[model samples]
Target chain A: MGEAIVVTSGKGGVGKTTTSANVGTALALLGKKVCMVDTDIGLRNLDVVMGLENRIIYDLIDVAEGRCRLNQALVKDKRFDELYMLPAAQTKDKNDISPEQVRKIIEDLKPDFDYVIIDCPAGIEQGFRNAIAGADQAIVVTTPENAAVRDADRVIGLLEKTQIAPPKLVINRIRPSMLRNGDMLEVDDICQVLAIDLIGIVPDDEVVIKAANQGEPTVMNPNSRAAIAYRNVARRILGETVPLMHLDEKSGVFRRVRKFLGMG
Target chain B: MNGKSSITIKGVKEGLVFLLDDQCDFVTLLDELHAKLDKHEQQLAGPLVHVYVKLGARQLDEEDKERIRAIIRKQGNFLVQTIESDPVAEEAADYASYRLHTVAAMVRSGQTLEHDGHLLLLGDVNPGGTVRCTGDIYIMGALRGTAHAGCAGHEEAIIAASLMKPTQLRIADIISRPPDEWASAEPWMEYAYLADGAMQMDKLTHLHHSRNKVLQAKGV
Candidate 1:
């Protein structure tokens, strides 16, 4: 059976949808059959991010309510034949679906795909519960901001209470220049606070917004740093050992000099 | 009337002590107090005299104490300083407040862990997390959250952490200075406490030296 992975962050606007879209696209590019599920319900945006918004005929709610078959609700990605997306209903709220129904849907989808990527909603309410219901593993996305890190810690705590394995962390939108200036929280600091394995780190790139605005996942743009980060994350998910990308070479030199001077 | 007296008045440096008979009935005690006050009306007609009431083994509720205050008010020259009773049985909640609870889980953001007594945590307290205790709080890991020791108004309670980088610290009702003041990370473990009604921080090594009783082990 395929492994179900849920992408979530307790706070809103921390790149949960973007991470889901990019990671799913990257996995498909790696020759794996992938199904992306948008569990945000009324606030669904994964379809738009994956450039599949125009093709959705039926939605997740319709499939769960038995109004349509699961295959009927899936929208095919334009670039990859192996990648499919199950859109959320724009009219339905998160309370409309129960965790058991979500679990059932994921179970049915698991047999056909190698990876089922569930994009979770922002809050720790019903939507979060429904998204994690069928997830065997979880990826907690967070930014370097204090509020985002705090929320990610809360999400990790909640995930630990579930049957899913300990969640991996993805620190997104890091600004290397700000990090060098000592204005942003360091990657080590975020890791120390969350105390979870770091799966990937995506730097702050303007191309992410540009690609998303064009209704394409950032991973489709090979030149973007965020795209490479997502691809590395996908490789890690496939059990490949990839070294963490260097955020900045100057910061490394600065840190080494400080250590040499015994001022670190 | 029996020859033995039920109420005795003694003069001390600070005030006049009224030792009430604990074995007597409540109504009888009140009557005797009234009679004694009336008999000594002339002696009580002087400058304001502090009166201290001592109930050896008796417990008086709020209404009963008010009654005693009213009776003493009849002697206009007397000021009721205090009314005290011997120690009584403690409630279960109070007893639980003296316990030490050890927890081995991280207190995550938006999560609060409260204990009736002291709290000993084995994991980090992430930012936005809260830990409240009636006594003291001892964190074996980093404390990046809010910690409130002596939540029940114990001024002597303390909070100690291996890495003291908390967002906020409170001892009893006194809050610490802003997070900016506590931004630096000291090399050694540190603790926060209330000293002279103000919150203060120091190395954990000096805790026993400052508050000798804090390190004393409880007797079985």
Candidate 2:
């Protein structure tokens, strides 16, 4: 059985799609069998971000409604043999999906994969509920901005109400220079306001944009700073006691990765 | 029946009197008193009808007092004169010792609490939720929300939360606004109290800080 993780953010455009794609790729590179599901039914973008949009012959709606099997709808990653994706249906609305159906799909995929990361839709509606229904853990993604942090705080409250304890935090798109100048909220400020254990802090990098546009997750490009951060986060999820990465510098990917892997 | 009237009156010369005993059923006693009053119905009832209810000293707990009040109010036509068997001063002292402290099972977001004594909450205090306590405030769940403690100027009063990440915490006249940075640290119990003439938070331990609690309840 695998860990079903839901990448959720209450506010839109806070890098949930980017995080899911990169983290899923990172975990698969570590030799873990991974499946990424896009729960944003009508507004699907995970497939596009992963560059698997043209290859989707069937969507989650078809598999859920029994028109096609789960395996037939899964789009295998071209770069990684262990990575696969179940893209959301752009034509279908969130109401067409149910938590029970999502749970059944994740349960079916559990024994075959080591990780199933669900990309949650924005807002605290049916779409959000559907994404978390099949998951064991939640990764709340937020930015350094107040609006994103506030929305993340609200989502944390809702998860607590649903009895999902200790949902980890991922602060995405952190600009260190702005933070140093007191222009952006620092990591400590976000944690203090959100009050959750942090899992990852992906710095704002041009490599992330370049990699996403190339249909390759930034985590695959070992030279990328955001990729190294995602790799450290994956190790943390695997129960490693890696010290936090320094987001200030753009150097030391190998040294930090070794330190994270306990080989340093 | 002790008195010949529907309202069985007991006279106490020194203090207020109430007669509630285990030997006599309250219903039967009421019925017999009413019968006696019916027998003496020939006398025209005057103004100021005083019906004294006798409650024993031993039966002065919450349940018995509420029951007696309920029964008296239900019994029509009786202008009941209720008296406590226990001394009022002693009762007031006891009541003051243990004030009303109730924490709802689920304290949702936007919920506010203004309590006098020790406030103990069992659920998580989410962000935007607030709890203001005059005495010590103890939350069994995570305190990731906002809280105000020792609001009545009890500086010695401490606020303890299971997991403290309050946006703003006020103790006495001091407030601690959360620093603008992420705190990558392990979860630990946090206790906030007055220190160095301001509010301070420290890990929960058997540590002591000698600070004067300025509680001005009387004209000094």
- Best-matching candidate per TM-score: 1
Lowest-scoring 10 consecutive residues by lDDT in candidate 2 chain A?
A: A250-259
Name the docking class for model 2.
Answer: incorrect
Misplaced by over 4 Å in model 2 are A163-165, A249-264, B1-127, B132-220
What TM-score against the true chain A does chain A of each candidate get?
Answer: 0.94, 0.93
> Which lDDT value does model 2 have at B50?
44
lDDT, model 2, position A18:
95
Clashing pairs in 1: none
Off by over 4 Å in 1: A250-264, B1-99, B180-184, B211-220
Candidate 1 lDDT tens digits, B51-109? 99999899999899999989988999889999999876322246234888899988998
Q: Which ten contiguous residues of candidate 2 chain B have the minimum total lDDT?
A: B87-96
Tens-place lDDT per residue, model 1, A155-198, is 99899999999999999999899998999999999999999999
After TM-score superposition, what is the CA distance of residue B116 in candidate 1 from its true location, in Å?
2.9
